[model samples]
Target chain A: MSVKIEASEGGRPHNEILGFGLIGSLVCIYLTYLNVLTGTEIFSFFGGLGAVIALAWGSDTIKHLCSYGLGTGVPSAGMIAFGSGVIAMLFATKFGIAAPVAALVIAALLGAVIGYVSDKVVSMNIPVMVISLIELAIVGALTMMGLAAMAGGSFMFADLVAGSTTVFGIEIASYGSSVIGGSVLAVIFILGSIAVQHPFNACLGPGEQQDRTLMLAAECGFLSMIGVAVISFAFIGFGSAVVALLVSIIGWAYTYMEYIKLSRRDAYDWLDAKPIHEPKGGA
Target chain B: MENLVLGIGITALAGALATVAGAAEDTESDIGSQGDPNSQVQLAPQMGYIHRIYNKAVSGEPPAYGLWCALGAGIAWALMSIQINAVLAIVLGSAIAVFVQGVYATTAYLGRTASLAKFEQPVYIDIIKSVTTVTMAHAFVAIFTTVAMCQLMIVALGHPFPLPLLALVWGIALGAAGSATGNPFYGKERQYQEQKFGAGVPISASGNIVRYAEAGQRSSLDNGWFASKLGGPASGICFGLIVFLELWRTVLFEQIGAGWGAIIAGVVLILVFMVIDRYIETWARKTYGPYVAETEEAAS
Candidate 1:
């Protein structure tokens, strides 16, 4: 019994890491295809994908199960999946629908088929890669076909055969882009994780570190507002500047306050302080 | 009603004066330590000017300041009801005001945090969530302030009132409610810290001087004081100033439209806040001595 328990525990990390990598790779491919073919901006598509990856990496299903036992993984998994779906939608909206839809269909079908085959096949990395590629292909294909159907064109297999050249071109570009973007992002993540783990790191010592991360992210978001301001001012006139500045200031203040409140609450928890008064119900 | 406005104006004036005095005292004391006592007095006015700017920039409760500023602008529009339709005037005013405050606050946060290194944890998720939440809240504040002021006007005239009075009422209500609601969030700590330190302990010598300096540094790079002050009075000041600018713009240029005015206000608010925050911090450091000195003095 002890030997069996030890084996099971030892096997889990390998399985989990493999699962993470597979899921991440598949998601990245699907998003990339959508961006390249659909005309989505690289930033929007990748931003959402990055968020989904972060959620998946941070979530520990086994830990949840051990702590709460049964039914615990659903909420966390649901949130990650929902966030991914939103990212996909946003990507589709920005890039145009053709590539995303095709990628979606191709990726899904491929993932399902490979996942099934992997049950019989004894290989590890190859199976994961096969599943990911299948899903990417299915997603791309289905997306394209669906759009074609909407345009009142034929949805024949022959049409897909003819369209495959354009589809393949999109696929290559997307794949190349994803690999570069994801690799760079992954390196950043790895470095950050290492710094956090190190004992003597001065920048982000362990106490309530999550709040700091959130703040940094919020700060990045302010860039979009500036972009909006510049665009509005250029198009509309100096009057636009007034509206832009007001909106930016108020929004910033509110978010800044919220960040402070969240950090304070976390710090208080770390210090074992009594609960502070919550906001009154009305406002 | 007149008394309240008078009271607010007086308080704002007093706060401004106190900030100036505090800076002067600090400059005088700081001169000896710098081995240049003569240069200190000349520097005092410059330092005092900076202190006022900082006070203005980094003062106020976040949501409340924005809310009040919008309300003030709304009231200003309602005051013009005789010339324009009441509803249109109120809408135009509140929209301009709220938009201005929002933009201002956003720029301030961006400018301050742009220099910091990225964090290890996942920042994007939390930031997106918080910003979305805050933006929605700000929008609501704008809507609510407009509605509340309109209601006050309806009751005051015993008939459908003119637009100008409605605008005035809206501005007054927003300012008053904001002050009342925001005071608890912004000044609560000041009150508590003051009480804890007692009247005898020089206000300047309070232990919070060290805490504030450290918080300033941390917040310069990271959002260290989120939970405690909820960005405190500094955020509030940004909100208020944005609203003030929105009102000023509307009064100055009627044809520019509310939307554009708001956007401009937002950007300026951020720029102004940063400038003031920089000086305020310098004053704090100069006045209080080095952070290490304060810590050592406290320990001994």
Candidate 2:
């Protein structure tokens, strides 16, 4: 719900969107903790395209603070930056303080104390808004621990207590799939929360551009790399799930052919295919 | 405020369902044969959690009251702790709560007569008829009535609300049941819309409305202004592959005879997923053609 275009046209510069979100979250937390410490899943589809280039720099700072109007502040600050970046990246990678720290700096310091108590306690001003809610909860806890370590390869904590903890009634199966990290990690935590909040809430308006909202935020990060290559092919195989479904159908045919060349410079497609010139006294 | 933070999070979920209803019958007979009909199942995300609470309740939100009152007190403590058959979990949980409360009461009575993101284009053909009636009402319902109401309240409401109070009662009951079925299509009396596309409502000769004057901008291949129509990303990936093959046909879901080959491979995968989603929406309108094809041939 943008009002102030100010000057829009496929905009970008802001230090190339925070240098591609702090160098794409330290290169997808070093190719997802180097395939969860050398065990490997073939550079896990570039760690879900480096957490979709760190949620296209926290959805281009939610298209520059919902283009200043802030109608439903870009999905209530991306649902409180993915609910405090998936509860501080699952309690700093399952309690044991992420094996001597660095669950993306404890989900970017718990998304800078829930974006400073929602911009100083529930006001939700937004602006730099605690570093775009700690870069959309440290790229949504590094794209949910790089798509739950590329479909349960290993994000550790004994492979999330053998693929998705159960405890008392016990499940902890390890690689031999107990619904591989339980119900495909609850369907990639609800399809990575709708591929990190439907690419800037369906590319906002004045036909909000920014290279067609970072090429529809890399076509919602290649539809979360076809939902982490079809739910991490229930423990990555079939040639790394046919190379993460041919790198998400060739990254959704090169970002939908540059989003049909930026929806042909829309004024809702030239005020409905250029005709109405209603001027003199027609007002 | 958000209904006083959803009435103190549904009265601390009715005091954690009266303190986990006295440790439900030996954890419902230790996950009672993972919802019986013995083993090897595939899918049952109860029509993918009612097509993700009617596509996040008409995209904006509201509904998901403390995760459907902790999935109605975790389906009465996961059918008395998974001993299952509370009349087959209330006849598949009242047929998945009367098929997601009759697809959220027919998209809250066609969003008070056609209003998905405030109507437009042949009233966005009735807002793509509530996203093709929530992607063909989850492939004509029966996503195995949510695999024993999600393995009887997420494996017997897992010793009382783990997974961050079950992701904050499934994201505050999917935003309080999509804001009580989108509060009777709030602020009604629209009379054909497109209010300057995404509101900021300006243009006027008494603001359009000779049946909402002329219009344009529709058909989006990539989440343009909320899924640029033309089978919005092939019916949101055919309602997420009919709730990921109805919970991947209940995991270890074996079966040879009697099962008519998993009902003829789920009727040939819903007739090749409606012929590859109407051949990828007529090859994405004959290869990336419409961002408003010459404003629909200069509006007829």
Candidate 3:
């Protein structure tokens, strides 16, 4: 099963797809925020979609940059993305409706600065390191905000730090836990990182195909959505949480199936396992 | 004025501590044969040269250190909240994190060596029994120093981020510093010394590394001995400069014009580094003169 591979084996150029994911996910996430202003949590799934799209793009960026022989840097890139992204995100939430846009800007600037440090002072010498890192940072910020929105129904500073204390017109003391204060933000950080980094790490080889890898990213993203949806129960309305959970589960199933199909298509042949024969005489 | 002075002092202390953390981190990673170079160590078995190196790359240096520092800071923060002495809390927290790091190293080494059994790669019990503790000791130092630095920034300099988050951020910076500045020394120089100096690693020599030491077969410890001198110190200085400059600007200019002064200083610093980096690149290209086949033929 020796198959020759060329550099053009992947589905699309990395940049074009990445640009689409970037702009599209940003728009969808902003739309989710706008929906929040309508006082309805029904459109919160758009936030999850935003996260998935950003992760898909981020995964592509990771694949592109880590190919420069980063060796173990695949995961490090993801961690740095979130590390900077979390700081930028927390800073951005201080703005009211402009939080998402603010987060994108801050995350971009932070990533660029870190990338500069990595290249100039540390002397990584990779040509695309700065741009890739910038993209990863934006992806980290958007994914974080999206998941936070999906979970808590709002990406506002007050809602994320100390959510409302009253429920059903009754004051519930000690129930003021928000996404950040309750440590849910930590889960989102790690979940987004793993989802963005894992697909490429697992699919990296001569036989790796972009379609399969992106599908796996989508699968991982949806799985992360399921996780955040469960956490949403702690903050959002029950109906919205259920809706998110259902949507996530459905999306995960579809993407997982597509990933499997792509894998099979790429494979030369399939072999079924059989039980091993015991030695002539039993041990 | 007093606040500025205190901030400067804290920044200086943090920068010094971060340097130690960076040095110790690179040394630990080299001893374990972690990061990009670890790929060669892994490939040694398949390439028909069984090695004694401890391959314990559970993850990249940045994320791994981030997890350790964050975990340590989290524990320390919790203990301090419960009225424990700060030093004791930090010690205990770092100790627990080191234990976790040791466990990860052990499992990683064991699992990796086990996978290479078919290639006659032996799992050196001595390496595991001894090297795991060595790496853990270094990790303990790195974690403790980083946590302490985070504490200094919070309590002394009035940094806004919480202890764990701040530790995570600095840990990432430390890891990136080590990976970028230090790893090349180990991966390019020490691990593949047989290659002509200044000639980059060729694609043909991907998995082939220098397998023999001066006396006998080399272990990761041998690499560590060489790396401790150049790689570790280089990484230390890189990280130290980053922390020192980053904090120096803020302390000096943060009070001016709604903190725009600090931002301007940061931009200026970046521009200076860009010029320096450009000069360094030119110098290297001139000195080395591209060690490719075409250049070699022309010279001949």
Candidate 4:
């Protein structure tokens, strides 16, 4: 089996693909928001799960960076990504509610600052750490917003505050930014983290292949979608949950089949070979 | 037929759970939003929260001791609330502790690792790659298990355990479990490190620290890499208890009680952790025959 994953083994540049996924998710988020605005909620279902495809882009970045043989190993990169992602996501949701565009800007800025510290102050020597983290934070924020949108039907500030405010004896501030935040969002955040981090982690080796890892990322993304659906179910967002569930199930089946096929193609001759033909009777 | 029945049953159950969650949301949705201009006060702070926190973190040229005191005080304040908000403690409070403690613990891990001890001038990538990654792994386990246990508490009992107590009890116990099991991942990470860096870590199948003598290269025998197999989890449990208990006691304890709690909890955690730690140590020694940690070359 191929253990080492070369930087060149990837089919496309990590940044280029990350850009595509980012733009794609933004477009999906915008369209979904528009749909939510006009009262045709039909399009909203695709927003959350589709946006996380950007995470596949993030996974690609992980494969590229970690392949250089990060001395600590790969999972740290994943943790850092998720760590930065979570903080960026929280900040995004806080502001994204008022002016949705603000969330993206805030996330990018937060990521840039963090990247700056990681590079200049920390002196990691890996110049790309900052930019990578910046992108990770931005994409992470977007994914979280996408999830909030799916859970609450709109990431509009008012909706979330309304949803999360726990009224105890008519006290005004039971919790701030409690809206768009729930056990459901908690589940999505954790699961989304796994999706963004797991594929590259599982596939890493000297023989690691880009395509296989990407497929693994796709499989993980689908599983995360399923997790989102279950959380949506918990909150009784039946329509959204069902839509997400159905899409994830179909997508998972397809990706899993492709993954299995890739495994077969990439396997040792013995494992890949058809069963040995046996003589039925004494010839 | 049996598979079909099981599938149908699970689907129904899932649907039922979704409906239940939806009902909960519906109840909340019933409340009217207070989105008037007065709510603007509430909204303004949310926007500037990041900026304010940022300024506090970086802008001050304060006394070093003062900052350290503030840090401890701040953590103590957060831990006090663990009783009322377990979820928040584990999520937000534990997060801060894990990041800081993860850094410290991982640094200690690197320092204690016989192979890595000689290396000078640690950089961000090296620190990030191993320390943060290892810390994240253990913390991830702690967090995931804490969440799972919380879920179980909810399902088995009608109400969830108080957040502070839960954080303390599970923070240490699950931290121990994590220390015992999945936490030694970094010890095995040398193969990758050797592959990438190629300084001095050569595999000597006979389990000796392979030395690198070539100019412009550093190498160490691979034999001692396994020294931290038990150390990984030991440190994990040790730090987990120390940090979690510090938070728990600070917020919950009386003046005299704090001392007793510290001594008692510290002792108990050590004793319990050591038993488990020794088991894993024995397990490793038995599995991989006793190996030497010394290198042929002088320590860097």
Instruction: For candidate 1, report its TM-score.
Output: 0.24
The number of the candidate with the highest DockQ is 3
RMSD of each: 21.7, 21.0, 11.4, 19.5
Model 1 bad stretches (over 4 Å): A1-54, A58-283, B1-238, B254-300
Considering every candidate listed, which one attains the maximal lDDT?
A: 3
Q: Lowest summed-lDDT stretch of 10 residues in model 3 chain B? A: B110-119
Model 3, span B1-300: residue lDDT tens? 787778888889999998999999999888888777878877766666555677875577777777678767765764564346999989987887686567557545644554444455555666767688888988898899999988988888888776767887888788889888899889888877988776677777766677678886676778778878999999999998998899999999998899999999999999999999999999999987765675767998
The count of residue-pair clashes in candidate 4 stands at 26
Tell me, per candidate, how large a share of the native contacts it keeps.
Answer: 0.00, 0.00, 0.01, 0.00
Q: Answer with 1 or 2, whichever has the higher DockQ.
A: 2
Alpha carbon lDDT of residue A9, candidate 4?
A: 55
Q: Which 10-residue window of candidate 2 chain A scores lowest in summed lDDT?
A: A267-276
Candidate 3 lDDT for residue B154: 80
User: All candidates' TM-scores?
Assistant: 0.24, 0.30, 0.59, 0.53
By TM-score, highest first, what's the ranking?
A: 3, 4, 2, 1
What is the per-residue lDDT of model 1 for residues B201-240, given as tens digits with 9 covering 90 to 100? Answer: 3434322211123323111112123312342233234334
Candidate 2 local distance difference test against the native: 0.44
Displacement of the residue B292 alpha carbon in candidate 1, Å = 13
**Two-chain complex of model 2, DockQ on C-alpha atoms against the true structure:** 0.03
